[model samples]
Target: MKFFLTKSYKLFWVLIPLVFMYGLFNKEHSLMVNIHATYFVINHLDFAGLIVIFFGLFGLAYWLMDIFNKKLISWMTAYHVFISIFGLLILLVFYDEVENLEIDYAFKQTLILLMLITAGVTVAVQLLFPINLIVSFLRKKKH
Candidate 1:
């Protein structure tokens, strides 16, 4: 119910190394994260590899919120974290070696569509961070 900046950022910081390590040691060896403009390509639709960049941004966001001494809106932070973790889990559970394996065409298309939608939602959620930062910078600090 109540999420704080410390919890929000710590969640991401803890995930960063795990994601980096996963991307590093992944057997597919095809996980390419182009954080260049913030896009990822994995085999076919391998998306979990992007978690490193995603989580790092979150950590940075939370840290910035703290630096600005802004009080986090608990529900907002909780929803953001929940959506992200849900998206991540969906990719990890169903997308492994998907391109290599011969699956049904309809199923593949549906899955791809689902993945894309989820990714879009996740990215959209990140907009909250910069907005949060700007608002925090502008408004008076909370007690």
Candidate 2:
């Protein structure tokens, strides 16, 4: 339980609000987020709200996987990767249909863009630890 409140988890909690603020101030829509103002961001997504949600979810996943395998972090990464891939597949298959929808065009587009970003970030996070280890090992051999 205490482990779940570490810096890494806090950092993720921070991202939800940073995203919301970005959405609010981004007049040009350059940030390109999918969050519905009335449905998602305004109600369910705040700093405290997201922290509780992620903390509970991660803690549950971590402990459940820890029971069978000790590699909780690896499993978490794998889980994120799997979900991100699923999101990408949905986006790819339904993109044309979504784009052609008559109503709420901007909202739909923003949602698709958000899905792309989530997929990208999840992949990057999963890869980063392994990539860093490889880079560090190569550097040590060179020295």
* Number of the predicted model whose TM-score against the real structure is largest: 1
- In model 1, pairs of residues that clash are none
List candidate 2 segments past 4 Å from native: 1-73, 126-143
Q: Model 2 compared with the native: what TM-score?
A: 0.32
Error of 1 at 41 (Å): 4.9
Best by lDDT: 1
Give the Cα error of residue 123 in candidate 1, in Å.
Answer: 1.5
- TM-score per prediction, in order, is 0.70, 0.32
What alpha-carbon RMSD in Å does predicted model 1 have with respect to the real structure?
5.2
Q: List, residue by residue over 14-110, the lDDT tens digit for candidate 2.
A: 4445444533443232212244564222221232343345444544543444343333343445444345334433433344345556778789768
Against the unseen true structure, what C-alpha lDDT does each candidate score? 0.65, 0.43
